[model samples]
Target: MIKIEGFQTILYSLVDVIDSGIHIIDTKGRTIVYNKKMAEIEGMESDEVLGKKIHEIFKFKEETESTLIRALHSGKKTENSKQTYFNNLGQEITTINNTFPIMDQNQRIIGAIEVAKDITNLERLIKDNILNKGDTKYTFDSIIGTSENFLEVIEKSKRSTRTTSSILIVGETGTGKELFAQSIHNGSSRSTHPFISQNCAALPDSLIEGILFGTKKGAFTGSIERPGLFEQAQGGTILLDEINSLNPNLQAKLLRALQERTIRRVGDTKDKKIDVRVIATINEDPIDAIANDHLRKDLYYRLSVVSLFIPPLRERKEDIPLLAQSFIEKFNALFELNIEGISEDVYALFYDYDWPGNVRELEHIIEGAMNLLEPGDTKISPNHLPALFKKKAHLEEAPASKDEDHNKRETQESTLSLDDYIANTEKQYLEKVLKEHGMNISQAAKTLNISRQSLQYRLKKYQVK
Candidate 1:
């Protein structure tokens, strides 16, 4: 009898440490014992939960109609099944429950003991995996690109999602800064929470304050007690695009909110604490913005705790083909076109021309090309490209003027030999690439797919900086 009792005690002790929530209910539907995890899921202490009626303690509606209770009363065992219930704190929880009737040696039912494994996280993982496999309509996966630079940005952003640090994205306009901010939020632990954005440049100085840190009722002509972006983004992320556009006064307020993690409504004296991850984007040089008094220096420092710079399309020409291919595939699926690929001349044209508008311009050009191509067209030729490219090609094809006229004509005509023309084009392209790579020879060479020594030879031959 002593050995049997010790074995029963060991079994009960093991049940307490099993991670899942375990509960034992008497025949009258009263909770006789609640494990530590069961109390945690209900957001309560074991002392307050134990010996209380299961329904009254947890305040769970389903406990009253629990299959475990019914099975115990009917003198049968309840098999494993899945169910969803709200805890004491009213958070939805999913559980895979197994319940069995407590019985004597003769198998007479007395009560029931339930072991419920919380499966909320598991459910979310499955759902996220499925959603990730689909169209990716509103997420980071939709930001299409396969360039090394773009892939590096994606990898860094993925790392950022694992933390709660403030992220500052610095890039020129139309560089998809906001898209990256949203992508980071979607990949974060707060994915299920709100991801709010406010463009500082879009609001007037007179209205920006109220829009961000909302006003209270009677605070102004039309003011009412309203939650601001900070409040709405609690437990999530708030993306402040064009953060440098905010005036000094608003910048001070924003800085305080970020530092203190609290905000005060327009008419409220009390500060309300908030839990929000801030992600700010700036199109201008942050240092220049501060020096020019367009942005507050202190605010700029705070926002740039983790800064990421996105290179423009002109800077990463090697990525042009990859970005173009991605855009072509996207448009083909969207428009149901079977256009195969870009022609060799079209690819060369893209390589030759500068993309002033960055990736956004590239996407538009691809869409236009897809529209021009027919169903049976295997390749999108240079003619199918925009008028600008065709114009450039025509300029490249024009014959050289005679030597007598060359001196009288423009400088471009004076040195219009095939070698000189090629040299000039190469110089223009190389100079742009060099500037984009911050004058780093190895990086520029790698971007151009040329040897560093080869790039140096060209640089010396053309007298390029």
Candidate 2:
């Protein structure tokens, strides 16, 4: 049994701890409850807002624009509607709001409460791209690649511009997947229309649906009838960057849209036709993404109408000189310097080093070295290079110690019994898989094709965390 006062305190504590912003107002529109999260979201103090009316703290264009006010007056609930308004500081704030009218036993509206999820950053990205009129920064000719495999990929991408089919680009991060995507869109016949590129991993699952499929006004509290990315990119191309990170349910919806050539907005009954060309990129192998359950197999088939794989920098080492010179020229214009190029020693270090970050890393390294060049220095030598390259050079040039060599030989010669070796190998594999899945027991178990309990038992037997 709990006292009424204690129960109220418990409720208040729970509300304060909630991740979403919460604000409650009486029938007269005077704010009675303002949680910490709400204060943070609005950039206001609760004490300042406590006795004030909703309109006093927030600047809504109309009374109806305030979901709390609308719910209080109309006795209607609004859920999952997006609201854009100004706080007291005049800073524009965007939130997904759910407002409900608090009614008495007689069914009369007494007060209203609003729960808001902050989505300002995500909203800014959508707004910036939605009205974009087919302007793209990169083209097929802009792509700097001369390697046989990379050139073949570029040629294939150029040929793909003839068709309106979906394209999937598979590559490591910073390997210029979006560059290829923009190039394809520019070369295609639909180059005159809008080109919108959205990273799928940018927003939460709750907001991404409305962003991708659009929303109907009555769908939720403050939701307006807005067009989604697919609608905005109609007759053009919508590039879904890091498509593997998209929610599985959204992937199914994407597949349906791709297959039917139509998309139904969120909370809408009717499907609308769209002529958007979908281009999706994944930082990892699609097959591995599917096997790890990060991507859907059926959706993969739908998206991979034409697939382009960009080779990593290490695999195409011959392009280093061209890429390095290109970056030098770019930096020369930016810094107003006329640095000629890189030296052979620097090129040797670059080739010897495995560029884990791919082309982007090379460009950054060049920029760093150029920034360090003296007034008379025309070339990027080993000394002008960053500390990372210097360290790599030191490690490569250093002679191995006899003690270290002896230990390596001893470890190589030592062997375990057959059963022991098998168990050790199994343990190593389990640890590797666990690390791959971020030590998520259930996902690792699923990948290993074993029951959770069985995996747990093995983990216990091996004392693996």
Candidate 3:
């Protein structure tokens, strides 16, 4: 038999080495052991917390919120519960905690233990990664705004962090839907696991299927056994960006995946169980998407159990300066420029203009301005703006009368050479169709009513990348 002292040494060793914070309290609510990790997380010295009464420290917090307190009073186990509060040092803390009552050989409650994993840095990383880089990234803090409408979405997302539910993020391009998805995942209980996203509109149906659900060995030439996005995201989150671009067949398959919590490799007969939370995003309104048959009704009902819309930049113009400052700071590091800020003229012009490309357009404009600035330049002025802005401003000043339409028609007629016009018009049509389908060549070709080969020839002919 192992000696009691040796056994005690092993138990204490196990507690000290683990990554999660550990706090143990006796039956009388007096702290027995506060491990190194726990001391670090609570921002206190072991001497300060050990032997202190937990009831005295957490008496006013919450009955259900504090797992240790609940276990102390009710003699019940609590698992994976989220709690947020300030520590003794006044540092705000958020953690997912698991607490249980220590039991004796006779099944009597002897003490209580609390285990917590801190994700403070993870949340910060998620926000920091999204600064002006346009990467598929975000957390609630990554999103910048104080507008009432914008903050409401943040509040809604904050509330969502408390549960595990499939969500649908609706927003136009550049409105930061992916950022919100990242924030939601980071704040969730599964924050320690992988967070993956697939752009549904970016590939053909056959390729998308293999990429998302994996492919079996010998299923097809060059196809190796693999775990698709759903399997890869087991115990975590998967974000399907542009979900409406998925074909009806894939939509049906996705519906089953969500309902059953299982997925099968592309050519495998066996099904694999997976624990994954999906967050789907769409640029269009759900009703509009369903009405157009672009998104399935059943899929909509399932994925949209929780839905959030990111207000467009035009709707939240008050946030422009804040967003611009963030972009300035970001680009300063990226371009190695020390430009301090934007000028009053540039700010005024930004307000007067309509941002067609939304926040993304603003970023591009700032980047363009930076490109023209000298090392000595400290601020972005109107003169540093793209020449197009000056031309557009002049045009905006002109009154829109019948004469304006006549002038527009005259300009359109005068600008096109017969051959150039045909080539330009064809290119415009192809580009629009390609963009509409998220650059899926097969889908774009089908919408254009042209053979894939024919569309290929035209694309090569026009040199469309």
lDDT of 3 by residue, 67-170 (tens): 67679778888675556666665676666678899889998998989898775553343346421112335667688999987898899999998888889998
Q: In terms of TM-score, which candidate is strongest?
A: 2
**Relative to the unseen true structure, what is the C-alpha lDDT of residue 154 in candidate 1, on a scale of 0 to 100?**
78
* lDDT of model 1 at position 394: 59
Q: Which prediction has more favorable lDDT, 1 or 2?
A: 2
**Model 2 per-residue lDDT at 67:** 82
Give lDDT tens digits, candidate 2, residues 81-118.
Answer: 77889988899899888889999999889999999999
Candidate 2 vs. true structure, TM-score: 0.79
Ranking of models by TM-score: 2, 3, 1
Q: Write the per-residue lDDT of candidate 1 for residues 1-465, one digit (tens) a residue.
A: 569889978877887787888888887877776887876665678777667666664434544456566667776655545566665677766666777889878877778888876656644643454212112135677676666766777788888988999998977776788778888888889888878777788756855686677677866422457677678778988888898888888899999998998999887888999999999998866655777898887887788777777766765677777777788788889998877778887877777776667788878888877778765787788768777656755535756579745655777566599966876898999999999999999999999986675576467445586
Q: After superposition, how far is residue 186 of candidate 3 from its true place, in Å?
A: 0.8
**Cα RMSD (angstroms) for every candidate in the order listed:** 23.7, 8.8, 19.3
